[model samples]
Target: MTKEENEKRLAYLKSIVARLPEKPGSYQFYDDEHTIIYVGKAKSLKSRVSSYFHTEVDRFKTKVLVSKIHDISYTVVNTEEDALLLENSLIKKYNPRYNVLLKDGKTYPSICITNEPFPRIFKTRTINKKWGTYYGPYSHAASMYAVLDLINKLYKPRTCRQPMTKEGVKAGKYQTCLEYHIKNCLGPCVARQSFEDYQKNIAQAREILKGNTRQILRDMRAEMEQLAEELRFEEAEEVKRKYLLIDSFVSKSEVVSHTIDNVDVFSITNDEKVAYVNYIHVSNGSINQSFTFEYKKRLNETEQELLQLGIIEMRERFNSHSKEIVVPFEPDMELENVVFTVPQRGDKKTLLDLSLMNGKQYKFDRLKQAEKLNPEQKQVRLMKELQEKLGLPKLPYQIECFDNSNISGTDAVAACVVFKSMKPSKKDYKKYNIKTVVGPDDYASMKEVVHRRYSRLLEEEQPLPDLIIADGGKGQMGVIREVIQDELNLDIPIAGLAKNDRHRTNELLYGFPPMSVQLKTDSELFHVLTQIQDEVHRFAITFHREKRSKRALESELDSIKGIGPKTRDGLLNALKSVKKISEANLDTLTDLIGAAKAQIVYDYFHPENTTGES
Candidate 1:
């Protein structure tokens, strides 16, 4: 924690760097405890790793980073770019706290066409070469749905099960659905459209996916003009309408900056331990989109790894469009077939500088805010207030609140919510089901829930909550304390919300004589506790309701054979709801839920089993 200590660590790291080979490779940094703090890649391991110790760098941030270095390790690669790619791969896999990570761990929709005689387009999240063509990682589900809607409207691609045959199109012996009737589908199954015509439409949809919007519009305009010349005024009007739709879609994209067209700007901010990378995407001389990535760690290798990941992830996430990405630092990242630039001087350079400035300002603002509160002050103030009011020992920085909810004891669930420094730590929220207790035994249920909650923490060697709050009076407080002492073997402070006859926040309840402490409604401490209690109650109740609904649906389906967890999940996801599955006929169910499971469903719904029996 001191400069002298840091210098000793840096000296050791410098010795390792001096011994490293001067070839392309990756490097890793470790703390005094030998924990890998950060990972990075460089064209030359020796040079890049040694640069961190350079005394000429006057930046405090750089100095601080260097001060944290305890040890260095490296692996030589074939090339600098190869090293970059390897570093990114390592960062993603390990998620080293210091590396700037790209991808918010959210899946975006991609359009996939199954490679069949008659390819069918579907909205999906996973894309592979096995699937014909994938268009996007569209920003959201709504945008993907909109694109699908537009594609259906403009192209009317087939959405049918009838297989394309050598003799002719095999028309399924069924009436065309509303999709076909509404002109959203070409009705190829009913033989209303020729295979050649459907294929041509598919080609056009693919072109749109390729982002040739201007060319597509131009082609549409020419067709409209041609139709008008041929006296087909109605056809010309349809073309104009389609053009307008495309125009509207394009216009919704936000413009970021006017000076640069088709460029992406990258910036990063770090607070010793955590780093955030922000990307500003510009298209057609306007900023269209922006994104940020948060990473943990304080190592040079980790920083470089983040830089590499930022580029690859942005490219993959924005692969639908053609654009160049600009980064302030030259990342030795290898992106096959993708162009990246670090402009030295020009309009692009100015944009890059602006982005760097933004990153620095963001770091400064965050640091200023962090310095104002100081975690100790925030924690001490909240805890001291709680202790004084509740009359317990020490400040309770780690507080846990519990709540239970159910409908007539059905799907009864209890939730334990944790707060640190007066801020909700959602990551620590734990839920439990009232399995042993039968109906509305709130006291018994509270004891069972608290025992289950803390027992796990004790087993895991995790930190225990400083104070525990229950959503009831003396009974709840007693149950909470009994569980902590008997089950957890720890003496933790316990209290309960003493609600009035109207079931409103009235007073706080504590042990033995059941002393009640009144709280002023306007007090910050009171408001904070109330907020935490309410949130836990709401969360527990919502979870209970969902569990109840799922349980009801699962119970109904348990009778069906060939329906294990995997198949049931597929059925539930494909059919969406139980009502839909129950109503679907054999063939419709088979197509979606698979043949084996479909038969089981048919047998369950219709005991006669005429539809599914061989």
Candidate 2:
């Protein structure tokens, strides 16, 4: 393709990529003549496929791969596993010229039952037809081994490779190994434990491998009870140990129960050219699997695409059957009966966020692996973190915070403070006098002030801020939302900063009805929020105090026993203020208000000179 053609092609690719669904699926990259060059899977098809043109990818191979692209296609799947299997199958079928081979990628071990007469149960990377049963293609060998170890501990399955036969045992040709000496095995080689009994144990072990450990627990409990009733203390004790082992393992694995029995959570985080995706699997409210991996965006794929692909890849790689997938976005894929959710503020949101954090951490670590620290790195890092943390679509280059203050139903006022790039924007700070509400009605005062502020901005056609923060709880936040959204018809994001009884910022509230968002108090975002809240509160209080002071200054002279309003006005008009009046000479005051009242006013204004506290 020519340079101009490539530019046009990139733009066209971007448009098509933008329409990719966020669901678990696989995608294909094609050259100019529509020859398939690469095949990939994604949890979000749109996010993944669209990312190719995100930036000028640094890797040479990626640059070539993206440059060769002309058209793209995708296959939507119900789960991540389906995407992975599809990606594998499609890659093999077409032999995409530019596709990168995942080396020994599917070599992870699985628990296998050998086809021998006395089947040996163990973890193996090889899948042979001679293996009686294969339990998993576990994402990690440790996971498969953990299950195998648990099975051996509970059921005492023989670990020996010695082939057992009735004739060999009858002829005394087989002897018990060290496993029997250590009581880890039941000596099936010597026939101390019959094949029927050992086979029964193996059957139960198979159930655990199949994720039906619950049935085994119930059966073990009943056996324990029966043994205890029969006065078989040793057998009952053994059953009790196995039951507790399974129960503890199960209980420790639970994550959340708000959804259903099975769920897969996918989250994505990315840098300029690379993306990291994290996957979490929850079964029976327990986290059964979690992983984070990297993806190189050949065409500048977005975080959305990377995360979607990660979900598909992780699910497919782990062979997960979860139908309900939790994500931070709607991948826009139509998978039958599979639900994708974007939770706001609940347990599900928490889990999704946890996965997001993992992705972010993984990306951070990867960046650090090659990171060269510069002066602006921290600032850039903070801005990006804030963008992710607040779920803001854009970086918070401009933030506006508001507060309302009243002094004993007097001097009703509000203040708006500006923060630009996490620093105070003093020149943009604004103060307002309460105009619409009577008494100490903070809600009305806030509504009036916000309406006036934004109304002027709208009339002037000024840019709205990236974020608006209200220094109050839901009630006050509702008023701001009403003014900013309902009245102005603007689509600005707003959050509430609430204080505890001690007047300290303790929670950040967001969403329609406003739910408290969890945050670590020591985090930089929390600190920034606290700073914004404090600045607005301080500004409002300062303005309120100044107004009250002015009123008090004007009224001090009027409080004199002999001074009336007319006299006080005359003195104030001449002297400008009580402070000025205090500095005025006796002759000046007497000239402004008559001698007797002027003396009273002068005495009140200069109480210190009159022997009383001023």
Candidate 3:
């Protein structure tokens, strides 16, 4: 919380790290709040734990984590593998912020075939290996559901969660379900279909799941012919329909080649901060599986290094151990007896192209996700860009821009529109009705608003803005500097925006004696300045128009005598207009108020007439 406190905590953490053993282990770094901020594996506990304190430990996240470290803890392990295991366990247990955990709050869906008597085939995210046979980690729910739909259509499998046993069915303990009634399932529990018969369909379903559909279809065709030869027309018809359904579904899948079996394909793309990897698992000539994931590059990691990391991470996550992997380019990583192919042309190249395309799409999707989750970071980036472009000493995280608006001299008003983190804070916007400044004096009006703004902020102990923007050239900037620096002795940086003859934003000006600060018209800094200028101008003009309208309305009503504020408001409210009060009949006017007062109001508008009502 304070510099001394932070220094004391850092010293404590360094002391703890100094005592670590030379053994392989896992280490934890705790923040000032005594919460674990990082979990790491170490081949040597002392060396790894002390690395954070060394002068050259320069990864952005590592540096931040080290700065917050209040304590260090370690668990010694027997081997490097054991260290890795323990580190993973601690990271999962604590979910440390600095760990490279790939979580987007979404897990690929899978189809599980329960290892029970009536083996229910269903789509699920959770899998207990002892309970079922899992077919996939499908990248999208729609794809998994599509396969599930095909399986349901082909096999008529039971989908209910009801437990079943041979004895239970024999004793009539099991009842027919809605699945059977809708024909989505054959009533296997009721013995409507024999166990062997159901297993036959399931065996074929396994082949389909493995992308061996052509072989399964051939077997189905042969069985159908045999059934037809035996004159079992209905049975043959059912097999024929299933064969056709599986054929149609298989046709939709992209097929590279019949020889492209039991292979994994990888593509990697990298920006400065992160790497995106796309994976495809090929089985029996078809793309059986696909997924895209990203990794944050810690230390300017190269594409080859990132690809190696991603390959290991993804294969372990997806549980793929294919002997051969096809990649866009060969990585330096060596896996025992695993071949990596970089295809120059043909279907393999096409497949590589597809995977690379997926990588690009994954990168784009992550940018969209980052935009949604960390809106403040977007504004921070803009502010930093603006500061660098203008060579400001600090980022203008809080900016207050002023605009003075008036029509000649009447309704002179100034508005202070605040931009916090490059976003408009309408609640912080202040409107100043001109005082101590007469007529349309932009410089004086600017000076008065700047003085009042900072003076009140100082009085209330509210934080002042990092920068001030005046909506004019050196003239307005000079006056604001007089108030903020010369008068209040505040050192806040002040800038100005000058307009061309058409009163549109032209260029930015800043300094003690303001001059043009050149910035590209298409740049983010220019866009931000334009937005601030437009917003403050709009806010000032809107306030000025409102003040002018209210004054005009009041002055118009003031011309009529005996029409006090109460009667004026009543006329506006009841008649719904001040204009309609003159058109009312004498009785109407009398009904609104007493006839005596109404006569004065009615007679004021029609002074030439000798009214009988009066």
Q: Indicate the TM-score of model 3.
A: 0.62
Predicted model with the maximum TM-score: 3
Distance from true location, Cα of 300 in model 1, Å: 7.4
Rank the models by TM-score, top first.
3, 2, 1
lDDT by residue for model 1 over 437-556, one digit each (tens)? Answer: 999888888888888877878888888888888887887887777778776689887887878889898777776667877778676678888988998988898888889889988887
Per-residue alpha-carbon lDDT of candidate 3 for residues 229-328, written as tens digits (9 for 90 to 100): 9999999999999998988887788787888888889998877677788898887788878888777754455677567656776676667778999998
TM-score of each: 0.46, 0.48, 0.62
lDDT of each: 0.73, 0.77, 0.81
Model 2 misplacement above 4 A = 1-36, 40-88, 92-149, 163-173, 206-212, 229-233, 364-614
lDDT of 2 by residue, 187-303 (tens): 878888887887788888776665655667888999999999999999899789989988876665544663445788888776665666778877655566666766655545555
Q: Which candidate wins on lDDT? A: 3
Error of 2 at 590 (Å): 93
Rank list by lDDT: 3, 2, 1
Q: Which regions of candidate 3 fall more than 4 Å away from where they truly are?
A: 1-109, 160-178, 189-197, 211-278, 282-287, 292-310, 323-331, 341-397, 402-414, 421-424, 432-462, 467-538, 561-576, 583-597, 605-614
